[model samples]
Target: MRLSPSLFYTTNCEPALAFYEQCGLGRATILLRWGDNNMPVRTETMRAKIMHARFEGPGVLFHASDNDDAEPMKGSAMMLEFDDLGRMRRPFTRMSEGGRVTVPLARQVWGTSFGMLVDAFGVQWMFSCSNE
Candidate 1:
């Protein structure tokens, strides 16, 4: 079985998508916009909203969509493990834009470079790279 997380952004999916891409996450492989025959509810107001989108990066694959409920995103995080610190820097910096860093990227007692932050879209993330 394969498990993939789906991120729901009430009205800000487009910007969120762009943000992830800037953070070195791959571009959306598939993007479906709300249309006439897709959703059960009225599509007029949501025509511009994203019905679904998939992005794939080195060790991550997630779906993102726009929802009407506007639920708050909390208590979940995407952890990224990298073998090289140099390869992880750009993404770490980009993901921190306009967001608060809960843990600055630094060497940990566990012998890894680690950090945690919330992205501009409220997605929590943990980045780690081994010292080796």
Candidate 2:
């Protein structure tokens, strides 16, 4: 069995997908849409919305969708750990832009560089890179 966290986008989910790509995290592959796959036609507003999608990254995976029925996300943060400095630093810098940083990237007691921030879309993230 496997478990994966699901994210609901506030908008059409396109912006969040773009952000993920910009961070080099992953791409959102649209699996299903309201107006496709023989699914019953939803409202005009939802026709273009993502009904189901998958975000796959290096050891990261999650489900995402955009619809009125989705609940707003809060009180949780996505954590990513990497052994490579270049891989971790790029995302930490990109995702922190236009977002509030709760913790700056610095050496931590755990012997790793750690940081936390809330992205522009209000999604929180935590990053840690092992010190070599």
Candidate 3:
């Protein structure tokens, strides 16, 4: 079975899809907004919203969608682990260039490099490079 990490955004599902695609993820699929699937969405405004998206990056599957209820936990964050630190330096740095850094990328007591940030949007994200 194939398993992927799924994330729920506040209401920026489309924008998030575009961002993830730019972040090396493949084309995402929207399950709800098709021509005729007939999976009644509660709100009409959400018709254009993304109900689900699947992306394959670095041999892993990542999923995303929008949380229409406005609940706090509906929109969660991610802490991505990378094996190639060299390949990550650029993207990680670029993601943090104009974002707020909750924790600078540095070696932790656990012997790995980790950092946290909240992007231009209010979404929180984390990145880590294993020292192994």
Candidate 4:
């Protein structure tokens, strides 16, 4: 099968959706905070916290939610393998501009030039180019 939506759980769904929208993803569909018949108990606080959201852009559907407010998940990285380095470089640089770079884009041990960047929102991404 092909790619579907990728979901992330956040404590603040509204802000997260706004961030993604700023990143060029379009409007997100937020789950009803109240008045929806399918809501779970004790989840009224999250009625506005994005029970679920959908963002469509760049040919993929991206989803996220404010499902949990406990502790932040750590060491989670998302790898976006690109076929066109030309198309990817700009967006990748923009997203990681104010963030951290764990590995600068350069020839790597795996025979590819790859870089690791953590975006402003703390999402880690690995960008790479295979021998072509």
Which runs of model 3 end up more than 4 angstroms from their true locations? 1-3, 25-31, 34-36, 73-76
- The alpha-carbon lDDT assigned to residue 105 of candidate 2 equals 82
What residue runs in model 4 are displaced by over 4 Å at the alpha carbon? 1-9, 25-45
lDDT tens digits, residue span 1-132, model 1 = 988999998778989988888877878888888873555444566786888899887677999988887676788888899998998888999899899899999999988999999988888899999855
- Per-residue CA lDDT of model 2 for 1-132, tens digit only, reads 898988887455777878888889988765677788677655777876777889997788999887766666678889998897777788898998888889998889978889899988778899988855
Instruction: Flag the better candidate by TM-score, 2 or 4.
Output: 2
The regions of model 1 sitting more than 4 angstroms off are: 36-44
RMSD of each: 1.8, 1.9, 3.1, 3.4
lDDT of 4 at 47: 58
Write the residue-wise lDDT of candidate 4 on 37-131 in tens digits: 76663465655455566766665466666655544546666666656667556656766767888888767777876788877656677777674
Candidate 2 overall Cα lDDT vs. reference?
A: 0.81
Instruction: Mark the regions of model 2 whose C-alpha exceeds 4 Å error after superposition.
Output: none
Winning candidate number (TM-score): 1
Query: On a 0 to 100 scale, what is the lDDT of residue 68 in model 3?
Result: 75
Show how many residue pairs clash in every candidate, following the order shown.
0, 0, 0, 1
Worst 10 residues of 1 by lDDT: 36-45
| lDDT of the candidates, in the order given | 0.85, 0.81, 0.66, 0.63
